[model samples]
Target: MKYDMTLTEKQNLTAYLISIATITIGGSVYNFAISYFLLNETGSALYFSINLAISSITFLIITPFSGVLTDFLNRRNIIIYGEFILMLSILLLFIVTYFYGLSLFSIYIVTFIRSLFNAIVNNAFSASVSNMFHIDNLQKVLGLSSSIQSSATFLGPILGGLLFGISSFELVLFIFLLLSLISFLFDYSINFELFKKENISNNFITDSKINYFKKFLDEIKSGFKYLVSVPILSTVIFVGVFINFFNAGDMVLPEKMMINVLDFSPIQVGIVNGIMACGTVVAGIYLANTKKIENHLNVMRWGFIICAFITILIPIPIYLEKHFQFNFLYLSTILFVKFFVLALINVPFIRIIHEETEDYMKGRVFSGLGVISSAIIPIAFILYGFIYDLGFYFLPNIISAVIIILLSIIYFNPKKFI
Candidate 1:
């Protein structure tokens, strides 16, 4: 695949990239700030995970309709509106924080609204990526995109930690608001042509039919059939779903260990996550320059194996600290490698989705994948929270390792699925 692009395509892509990076940074900081605040104040992973679960479950449900929205509406407008709503919501939350301290219920309410907007913006932006770049350069562009995003993902927590450590959480929220507004401006720069294959005349009326419940359901069904039509793509989506579900243990358990077992402060946790992002940045730049890996499945398969090993070993640092008096940042070390491998493994998967699906179908494919991937995060989050409350912190890691290893050995054999 040739990597060359027209000047206009280049500009649009650049604008889109900057826009997404800004918003992602804001979102990441918000997540870290809140997690640290809740964990510190309540000292309960259960409450924090419950809030997270509610948001995730709502996000899962909204995603299907969101896909229909992305396909039916102007994709750019959908992105723009989504950001504005999120920024507004954060502003309101900031106001609430200043006037009255946030209760658990207030947090859940805000999380619910944020999830709706996030489902729209995230799904639309990802779908747009498929449309914006050339196929030859798609993987490399995706890698570069991941690298840009890694800065937001990894550094957000550190920024959040520092902001929270030195100042108030509201300050972080204010910064998030500013970022969102700027992100929307960047997003507005690109133009879209989603009607490449469809009729242009009277298109507005035809697309409006999607507003009806029946038409909406029909559209959602079409997206599903499209995904199932491709065996490898279908398998990939299923694998992603299972990975997300089982990996919930890793998400919660590690933070729990870091907080209680490793005795790391939020700033330290942020630093570890930031370091992990740095690794991803390096991996991403390499992928951006290198040609695509011919066998992306194998790359992802090995990723599972590497993460499985790390999952099993996650609890060891705490053991060492308690028994052997080792003082290394164990969680940070494992996460660094984990995110680096993730950049390799995930960027390719995204490229495949873009390569496999058509533009009109991009909405359903991305949204469907999102729905399934998020289907059980609530359950996983809440269940893991209970596991932590019961002092089975390391047990979840053991379970996750076994699940991942078994999946890698059995499920990853292409002969079975492909």
Candidate 2:
């Protein structure tokens, strides 16, 4: 795992990776158990959807401001305090679950609080990345981090199902609490300021003697101003919002078709999901082994194109439904390639943002991008869900692919986008 890093650098990297991994794994397990737990308790999918919405809606509301806070505040403190709060929250949940069992209201409240802090911590961590490691190793670190996260996400649900099957809900919470503590300790050991550059302006302060709230507002305005000023950066972000909306088809249609259209079993659906996640992990590992990417926009555009082409092929197996094994294999193969290409799009897009934006502006820009990108996902999901319900099972992918291909061509002007 050692590249050209020094001992201290390596230690910091390890601590950061471990911290993120533990947090993700714990969260994944908690999420899986909580969803089914809520449904079983209430016998309603509405509660589960509400729980999911709480997280997403909280992120939408908090993320933009979190970005400003990330740039203004001591990032290290933000992360540490955020993790500490998460640990305390989980501890509280553990106690509540053990004494009184779980209530829907209590669960909702905890989810909101967790989402709020997660938004802040995620923004701070993302904005801190460029300052966390050497430029030469930036892509490598990002790739490795992506793989770590993808792996945690892949494993968390499987582990959650296993644990939740045999153990008490309180035990699951207790285990998550322990992992949270481990993550907090690892985060504490990281030196977030070690690689920070000098003379970067602190947007939270001003010689105009303004109040803190006024300064914060001014900083946010400046951040947006800077974001629009960079043609390439903002353009790519806009493209991301556009692409991500259409990308929801990939999320919605596959499982829906496998079950509703072809009548796949639980085991078959689970295997398909495992294949999708494995694609992401494999792509991340591939990127990590490479040194750098040239022409990030080009790579991302091609990735999108390839994914769109694959998306059109996803419904082909429906015609061959008589052959169960063939249908499964075809769907699995295409979905794997789709996710692999999707993963390819992410690292370069991030690298582009890192390279193009000013160091001081990263938090706001990233946060702004986050807000823009995330807001569209739920909307996309709703639209795709509606289309699917309308008996347009195959239209979603085909239409989405056509739109992507057209957008790619329309925005293919190098001078404007690159």
Candidate 3:
């Protein structure tokens, strides 16, 4: 099938894919190292909760500005700057570990810095993609991007786990820094002029320089106003938010399950996650190649339904571990199945978001979505941590699944909103 993308478009897309893969590998490594380090050192759920809360707040506070900056500045330059900042933060992590010793507070500070840079870079990157690709092709590109990210997730942990096993945390941090530096070079090498268009005045930024926080608040208001004015877009955002809410458990539960229920070593946990990443890679490629499916809304609805149903089966490993005895192959199979279903839904959903949004609005819209989606993650993490502490693992998954199903029904029903 002819995909209707030009040679230049293909080149740009390929560059983006490469860049994403590079950065995602670094991100995955950092995530693995920080979580592992924090859990081992502090051994305090409160510290984890605190770190998450600080990072979430930082993201929320900076996202609006990041969106505005994407609109106001050269997005390519913004991304390069963000990468440099990330590199510095990673280096600081290494310094802290190697010289000052591993302090939880210092680690939390680095995490906050890392998350802030992530917010900026992500907004700029999304905006750049929206500008470079036509709407019809957006979904395919997003699918491919998701696949790349998932593949990185699969490999990054294995590398991180191995490195952590042999070397100190400082070594892992140094590797992260090196990867970020490489990503920066990639960002620098890209020709921004290739994607440049006439800069239209973003009325939102006229007063932004005068009072940054006030402007941020107004930009956020404008974003919400835009959403409200566009019912279809608003509905889409709401649906996306609900979907994220349900899937939030997937992020936290699997690690906890691996450690607590399955009693797997860190390496084994990484392997299982790597297998799940393989599933996501496959799903991403499939979605990228598939021709336009009829009724995207229907596809999305069914995707969420599938995800909800699959989530119900997530407890199978735990159940088997308890009753049927610990079987490595069985647990891995169950986890892989769960991740496979999630990837199936996630790729399509990502495509929809990329396809549906307009270029000018993409940054703000995505930032808004990020705010809503991630706003609750810290809370969910804390809640899940408490539940685990209370010896209740299955309830959170069940509740999340049911909530997703209900939200999907509401989101898919045209009569409800339209």
Candidate 4:
């Protein structure tokens, strides 16, 4: 369906999308710069990892409260004000580094503060996108947004690398400040009041005469209650949690498998990563332009089945390379194909969140999603690292495949979900 908007409204929508893409790209690069700065300043790889852990902990602490606030407040204003705050933070970084000389502790403080508020902006902005684009074509828009974001996963690092090498710290910080201000201006043009419910009887009072902490707990509980009421949403989040949990070892396993088992060189590993990225872009573009999917959940089930089959094949290369001398590129081919299937999984998953979630509750839902999706990575990494050291190298991968296949079969049946 076409967008239901006047010319000016369409223009405003386009600007907001551009703002989202711009902010995402800028944020990605900025994150890379922070890591780069820390590594250079501390001269210790362990310090960089420590910084990441601190940032992750901060995210975990602030995300739940931010989700609640997004639901309570104005989304557009949150986005606008949030960007300005980010811009000021960048400016602070620039001044601190240029004048007093940057320290590891100072960088940590800045990153922690920004990470807390960035969680709010992320949740509010995501919910706002659904509110702004309520038509059936939300999938297409989300596809394009994903493509733009995935571009950052590749482009942001390259840009950050070049800037880190070529420019002064102040110059790089200035660029982020400029980008954040630009995003703030674009978001400011959008009036979020149009998307909010104004006539509600529960205007933050009459009902909340109980204890403050108890009321807060109840408000948070309402999100879970709503999720329990919707089987599809609960199932989707469950699917994300398990799949992402199993996939955590992926960060270490692929590199280990490529270098140790297949005996591939560093250059070959880089080429394989490039291919995976190319697959993401191609899949995102295909979904963005393709006709609407009438059976999103059914396709998602098939996507899971296909990925499960691919996962079974991935470990085959290790066994085969020792016996039959297949082409070394075989691993790359399988990895590329796997990511393509991963892209397939995203289409229905994003569509379900956009379509199934209620506008009023979207802030909480997206925030809750952020918490659930991220809450597993560290545990999975530790668990996988433990098992990978037990000499049963492929055991984790086997368990991963089995879990995906069983989840697809047991929980995500076509008849049940559809």
Candidate 5:
């Protein structure tokens, strides 16, 4: 791989980093904002389950189309457009909350729109990153990007939590809206010439001439067919699906663990999540700078194993609290350790996905992963909720960990089904 960077490439890199940072901040805030609002208003696990299910469905529906558009359009322009739509969605949420009461139905509608934009924006961002860097450099770039995203993740929740604590949800929406506008501006300023040059070889004109709906269906089918042709890609998507399914448990588990088990406040819960984000930031930086780590598939396999270990270990604090009446410091320490391990594992897993897929197919591969992962997440969320209600909160993690471990073993063994 070439190491030389042109002036224009440097500019594009700067623009891409800023755009991603702004978008991550806006997106992270929206996620925390909606989940917090719904938890406060409906005060039911079932409502949270339903909200997640709807969001997953929205992503499932939009991701394939977004993936196709990523290939056909200028990547930077696609990202800018997605940011504008996301900004509009935030404004709509503000309008609904200001005029009408914070009704569950209203929140659901706003969140669904936001989720649609999120899917598009995410696909665009991933595709843009793939377009910007070479395959060999992808892992490092992805690690750096993940770090930036993790930094946003660290800030967004803390900001959202503080704003929600001090002012109304409407005020938080106003802040998110302002941030999104900045993001839109940043996105618009990015040059798409390099992306256009790279994609000129693609038959965009002929592809664009097809009927929209039929084209969408064909694109979706083509993405799946492409994945099937590549054994590694298929395995990677399956791994991602399982990883996301169990990871959804994290959203509901923290609240349950804090309130019911540790008897902590919302602020404490926010602190814990912030700590996890900080760990992510550290892992991202470490992975980005480490140049000699070339065995991405093996790295990913170990990441899964580590993540599963952390997942299974999470219930230890609860067990201690129940049987031995541990202090808050002890419990928090355990949770923080678990989060740190999770962060360490996730950075490599994501790097592998970014590095393995070809640049042209990145959009479809990631979006296809999104579609499959989203389809499974709804069921996972609902199932976790039900099992939580049944006093079996640990069961989901235990089952998911076992499944992941088995899959990882199979994935590592070349003789097994690749």
Candidate 6:
């Protein structure tokens, strides 16, 4: 019943990072393997797209409540239990696949449930970051977390592809199950309550059923109110929505161009994607080693602007493929720069939000931010998918670049921050 507050700040941060790294690695590999499995099983791009949309839809529907849960419930238990449930779900899937069979409906259901828990766990972890470590170490932790994530992204597809090619789908699921167990152990080691706020602790224990329901609604409303009350925060949310809509190309265009247009082998495509993720890794390292940024907003603003310019070059390889042999080097260089700039934009923005928001409000504020910023993404993905189907591979990048440039011009000014 006692809290584990024995670990020092450095130890806590290390445990937290290792925990995140393990989960991300497993999740990434599972994602890659599942995508391929679904495509091979269904042989329908439409079904694949629908499967993709499930996560976003789940985020929109469940994320609002998840924010409240993180704030009101025990954060450490939320993370630990959420992760446990995720692992259990996947284990169940593995057992079913091994004994009876795996159904598409089951896949969709598990994906939805896992997505819901992921939102809760992610909100808790993000909201707890400021409480877990000193404010001075916040950037370092964020930076290192980003590095872990980007490294996972880089490794997942390659490893997943190798495993899938050599092993069965059930085996991949079991591997992920094992990885999740490892992550759980690391997560259990963290003393999330070490810096816990007294009044915030055990919030749900004191509330009656009816009072808790009403209080949850009020908390959500207050979170939204606080988000809009801050001019820069609201502006950042708007900009996030705009950029994310266009940035959907980051997920779609790369595959469409590399695999569909340029006739890249699976290995070639993986290499290019890995190279882009490496750019993010480098940027994360740079941020982790640096001192506090005085004008994070300015840094973010220019980062977006630079990324927009880099995005415009994404389709050049496609255009030149008709005349000469398609060299991935050119496209890789462009993506490396683009991803690097994106990391710069993202890390500072997250740090700003964490630094500005009060501890009690961080969960809801971040959840509200997640909802608004992501609301446009599914639509954007559909639009880009439709456009790519029409053989307009270059159109998405051009459209994204122009819109991001215009939005940055209008919204991302130094004066706005002042």
Which candidate wins on lDDT?
2
- What digit string (tens of lDDT, one per residue) describes model 1 on residues 1-418? 4557778677877887787688788888899888887799999999998987788788878899888788767787888888888888989999998789767777788899998888988888788775666666677777777788887786676678788889987898899999988888877777665223452232423665455777768889999998999877887778766876777776777677767777777767766667767878888899989876877677878888898777777767666655322433566677778778877888768877877787777887899988776666767888888887787756777888788777777766656655
Of 2 and 6, the candidate ahead on TM-score is 2
Model 5 lDDT per residue over 54-138, tens place: 8877888889988887777667777777778778877877897799857788778876877887788779777666456545555
Candidate 2 Cα lDDT to native: 0.84
Clashing pairs in 1: none
Candidate with the larger lDDT of 3 and 5: 3
Ranking by TM-score: 2, 4, 6, 3, 1, 5
Clashing pairs in 4: none
lDDT of candidate 6 over 266-316, digit per residue (tens): 878877888888888998898888776767777877788787777677777
Of 3 and 4, the candidate ranking higher by TM-score: 4
Candidate 4: what lDDT? Answer: 0.73
Q: What is the lDDT of residue 144 in candidate 4?
A: 70
Name the regions of candidate 2 deviating beyond 4 angstroms. Answer: 1-3, 203-214, 412-418
Please give the CA lDDT of all the candidate structures: 0.77, 0.84, 0.73, 0.73, 0.71, 0.80
* TM-scores of all predicted structures: 0.82, 0.95, 0.83, 0.90, 0.82, 0.89
Residue-level lDDT tens digits of model 4 in 255-322: 77777666777767767787777677777788878887777666777777777666666666666555
The predicted structure with the larger lDDT, 1 or 6, is 6
RMSD of each: 4.0, 2.2, 3.6, 2.9, 3.9, 4.0
RMSD, model 4, all Cα superposed?
Answer: 2.9
**Which window of 10 residues has the lowest lDDT sum in candidate 6?**
1-10
- The better-scoring model by TM-score among 1 and 3 is 3
Report the number of the highest-TM-score candidate.
2
Worst 10 residues of 3 by lDDT: 320-329
Q: Report clash pairs, candidate 6.
A: none
